[model samples]
Target: MRVPVQKQERYIAIRNVTILSVVANSLLTIVKITFGIIGNSHALIADGIHSFSSLAVDAMVLLAAKYSILPPDTRHPYGHGRYETLVTLAAGLLLIVMAIGLFSEAYEQLVGHKSPSEPTSIVLIIAFAAIIIKEAIYHYTVYIANQVNSPMLVANAWHHRSDALSSSIVVISVLGYMAGYLWVDAVATIIIASMIAYVGFEECLPAINKLIDTSINKDKRIKIKEIAESVNGVFFMHKLRTRKMGINILVDMHIVVAPRISISEAYKIAETVRHNLLDEMEEVVDVLVHIKPENTMNSLDLPQRNEITSRLQEQSIEVVEKIEKITLHYVDGKLLLDIDLPLNIIQNNNQARFISQQFADFAVNDPDIYAINTYYHGTVYDSPKVFQIDELHDFIQDKN
Candidate 1:
C-alpha cells in the first residue's frame, strides 16, 4: 500500500526526534560514567546507567517507526500501528527492569561496610547539567510525540523524564555527600530507582489496555453515541463499539431508520453517520454503520420471500399467478405480508373482499405469518396511455 503524505510526515518526525534522543543519551552516558568514576560518586554512576536505558528506548523507537509506518496489508489488515504499541510496552518494561537493577546495586552499596571517599564539586555540576539537558530532551520529544500522535514516542519521552528525575536525585545526594552525609547518596539511589519503577508502571498501563482491545473511555463512547444519533435520518443507535489501534480509533455501530424508507435512503443515512463520525472525531480513522429498522430486537426469524411465495402458491395456486408484487414485513416476531394484484382480476367489490378474507386466513394456521393484506390496482387500460417512440415524436412535433 502507498503511504499517505501525512503518514510519511509523521514517520519523519518520529525518526528525527528518536535520532536526537540517541545522540543526547549517548553523551550523557559517557559524561556521567567518566565523572562518577573520577569524582567517586556511585549514585552518579547509577544515574548514568539510567541514561543508558534511555538509549535503548531511543533505539526501539527508531526501529518501531520503521515498520509502524507501513500501510495496511493482507496479513495485518489494521496496519502496522500495533508495532509502535508493542514498542511502548517494551519501553515500559525496560524501565522497570532498569529500575530493579539500580535498586539492587544501590542496596548492596548501602549495606556494604566499604565506604568510598567523594571529593569533588565537579560531580555535582555534571549531574545538575544532566538534569537540564534531559529535561530539555523530554519536552522536545513530548512535543514531537503529540504532533505525530505516536504512543511509542510518548513512552520514550517519559523515559527521558525519568532520567531527568533520577539526575535531580543525584544532585541532592551529591550535595549530602559533600556535607558529611555519605549514606545520602546510596539512599537517594534507592529512591530514584523506585521513582523509575513507578513511571514504568504508569507507561505500561495504556499499552496493556490497548493490547487487550479495551474500549476507549466512557466519555468518548458517549460522545460517539451522540454524534451518530444526531444524524438527520437516524432514529437511534445501538451496539456502538470502539477500540484503539495505536493512536487511531476504529468504530462499529448499528443505527435505526424508518422501516418503510427506501434502501437507497437508508444507505444514504448510514453513509452520513459514517462521515459525521470521521469528521467530528480526529482520532477515528474508520467507521462501520449498520442500518436496521426500529424495534429490530423484537424481530423474528421469519421465512424469506422465496419460501413465503412458495407457501402462498400452496394455498391458492391460481390467485398467486396474479400477484404483481409481494412485500414482506418482519416485525414483532411475526411476518406481515402485502400482496398486490390487478383490479381486473376481481369481478366486483364483494369478490375483492372475499379474496382478501381468503388470503388473510393463511396467517391463522401459519406460525410465521402474522397478517396478510391484499391490495388491488387498476390495469394499464384503466390508467393514462403510454406513448411509443413514434407517438412521442409526433406529439413533440405537434407541440413545436
Candidate 2:
C-alpha cells in the first residue's frame, strides 16, 4: 500500500532537518577545531571534539530516517520504524561515552595541578560566536524534531544544545584562567561533562522503555478508551494495549458489541474505532481491533472455532457440505450459531424448514448451542446475491 500523506510529510521533514544538522555540525566542527589549535585552548579543542561527535549522530539520524520510512515487508511486517529507536539508543550511548572521556580528562587536569594556558582574543571570539551559532542550531533542530515527532531527532537536538552550553562554559573558563583562577577551566569541563551525561541518560531511558514495548501513559490510554467507546455500535472496550514504534504508536484493543448485530456490522464498528483513532490522535500508525459480543466478556469456557466447526461437521455431513460460513456468537454462557448456506441446495420451503429443524434438533441435544440462524445466498451463476435474514424469512413463508 502507498504510504499516507502525513507519513510522507514526516519523512521529508526528518530528512530536511537531518541534512540541516549535518551542515551545521560540519561547519561548527571545522571552526572550533581550527581555532582551538591556533589559539592553544584545550577547552575549545574539547568542545570541538564534542561537535565532531555530533556529526556522527547526525549521520546516524539520517540513516535511521531513511530506513525507518520504508513500507512494511514480509521480513519486518511492522515496518522499519524501530531502526530510529535503535539509532537513538546508539546516540545516547555515544553521548555517555564522550561524557566519561571528558570527565576523565578534566579530573586529570584538576588533580595534576597543571596551570591553564590563557586563550587568546581570537579563541574567545570564536568560542562566543560558536555559542550563539550552536544555540541557534539547537532551537532549529528541536523545532523540526517536534514537528516530525522523532525521538532520534530530539536526542540530536539536545546534543547540539549541550555543545552550545559547553561553548558557553569554555568562554567563562578562558576568561577565568586569564584572571588567575587556573582551576576554573577544569571545573567548567566537569560541569559540562555532567550535563552531557545527564542528557545522555535522559535519552537512553526513553529509548530503552520503547525497546521493551512499554505502554503509553495512563492519560493517553484513557483517551483511547474514550475514543473507542464513542463509536456507535461499541458497547464498551477493554484489553487495550499500546506501544511506541519510533515516532508512531501501535494499538490493540478488544471492543464489545451487541450479540445480535450482523458480523458485517460488528466489523464496521471496529473499523470506525480504528479510523477515529487515526484521525483524532497524532502518531498512531495502526490499530488492531478484536470484536467481542458483550455477553462473552465475562465468560471463560468457550469453544474454539475449529472445535465448533468439527462438531458441526460431525453432527451433520450435509451442513458441512452446504454451509459457506459459520459464525459462533457466545452470549450469556450460551452459543448462537449463524450459518450461511447456498440457496440452490434448498429448492423449496419444505427443504429449508427441514434443514432448519435438523439444525435446531442438533442444538437441542448440544448444551452449548442456545440458538441457530441460517442465511441463504443464490448460486453464483443464478443470482450472485445473498438475501437478508428478513428477506429469506419472507421468501420461506411465501413458499409455505
Candidate 3:
C-alpha cells in the first residue's frame, strides 16, 4: 500500500521535470544558437549544444523515472529501480561525450587564430538571460527530486545545472571576445568541459554499484540490525543481505531465537521485524526472514518427561497376596484410571499334584479363591498377570 503512494509521487515528479526540461531546452537552444551564429561566436554555439544535451537527459530521466516506479514482475521481483541507474549511467556517458565535443571545437577555434567579430546587443542579452532561466530550472528540478526520493531525477537535475554552468562560461567567453582578449574564452571552455566530465564520472559510480548488486551502506545495515535487536525473542541476526533494484530494496536475512518458542510466537517475531522495516524504510520492497532456534530445548525435555512418569506411578500400588498386586493407576491427574490385576491365585506344583489325586472337590470347594495355574514352585513362577474380570467379581463378592 505504501508502495503505491511512493510510486505515484515519483511519477508526478518525473513528468513535471521532463516537461520543464524539454520546454526550457526548446526556448534556450534557439535563443543561444541565434545569438551565437550572428555574433560569429563558436563558444556560444557550443553552449547551445549544452542546451540540447538537456533534451537527451530529459528523455533519460523520463524513461528512468517511469520505469523505476513499475510494480515488481516475474523477472524483476525487486521492481525496476535499477533501470533508473542504467539510464543515469547512460546520461553520464552522454555528458562526457558532449563535453569532449565542445572542448575539441573550442580548441580548434582558439588555435586557428581567427579575428572574431563582436556580438549584437540582442545576442548578449538573450544568452545571459538563458543562464538565469536554466539556473532556476536546476534548482526546482533538484528540489522536486529530493522531495520524491528519485535518484534518477536528481541526476537529471544536475544535468540541467551543468548546462547552466556552461552557459555562464559562454556568457564569459562571448564577453571576452567582445573585449578582444581571446584566450580567456578558450580557458573558460576548458573549465566547463572539465566540470561536465567530473559530473559524468560521479553519476557513473552509483550506477555501476547498483548494476552489480552492491551491499547497502553501513547506515542501512545499522538500521536493520537495530530493528532486529529491538524485537523481544530475536537474539541475533545473520546472513543480512540487501540490494537495490530501483527505488525498491530487497532484504533477506536470518533471525535467531530461543528453540522452545512455538511456531506462532516465532511467526509473530518475524512479522514485527517485517512491519518495522517497511514502516521505517519506504524504499524496502520485500523482506524475507529465516528464523533459527537455540539448541538447548531438547535437553530440557528428558527431565520433564521423567517428572510426569514419577507422578503417575504413585497412583499404582496395592497388596500383592490379597489381590495379585493389581491396582488402579490414575492418569491425567487422577481424572482417569487403569485397572491392573493377576489371573492366577496359586503357584505351588506340589499342591496341584495332591489336589489332582481325588482332591478336586477341595480345590473347587474353596469359594474364596478362583483360577490357579501350576508354575515355578513346580514349574518356575513368573510375575502374576493382570486379569480383566477380577475387579468386577472381587468388588461384588466383597460387598456381598
TM-score of each: 0.87, 0.79, 0.70
Which residue window of length 10 is worst by lDDT in model 2? 388-397
Shift of residue 328 alpha carbon in model 2, Å:
5.0
Clashing pairs for predicted structure model 1, backbone only: none
Which tens-of-lDDT digit does each residue in 61-146 have in candidate 2?
88888889889999988888899999889888988998898788778878887766778888889888988888888888889888
List where candidate 2 sits over 4 angstroms from the true fold. Answer: 1-4, 297-329, 336-366, 369-400
Query: On a 0 to 1 TM-score scale, where does candidate 2 land against the true structure?
Result: 0.79
TM-score sort, best first:
1, 2, 3
- Per-candidate Cα lDDT values, in order, are 0.81, 0.83, 0.68
**Model 2 lDDT on a 0 to 1 scale:** 0.83
Best by lDDT: 2
User: Which regions of candidate 1 are displaced past 4 Å?
Assistant: 1-5, 113-119, 298-300, 342-351, 377-400
lDDT of 1 by residue, 367-393 (tens): 888888777665566434333223333
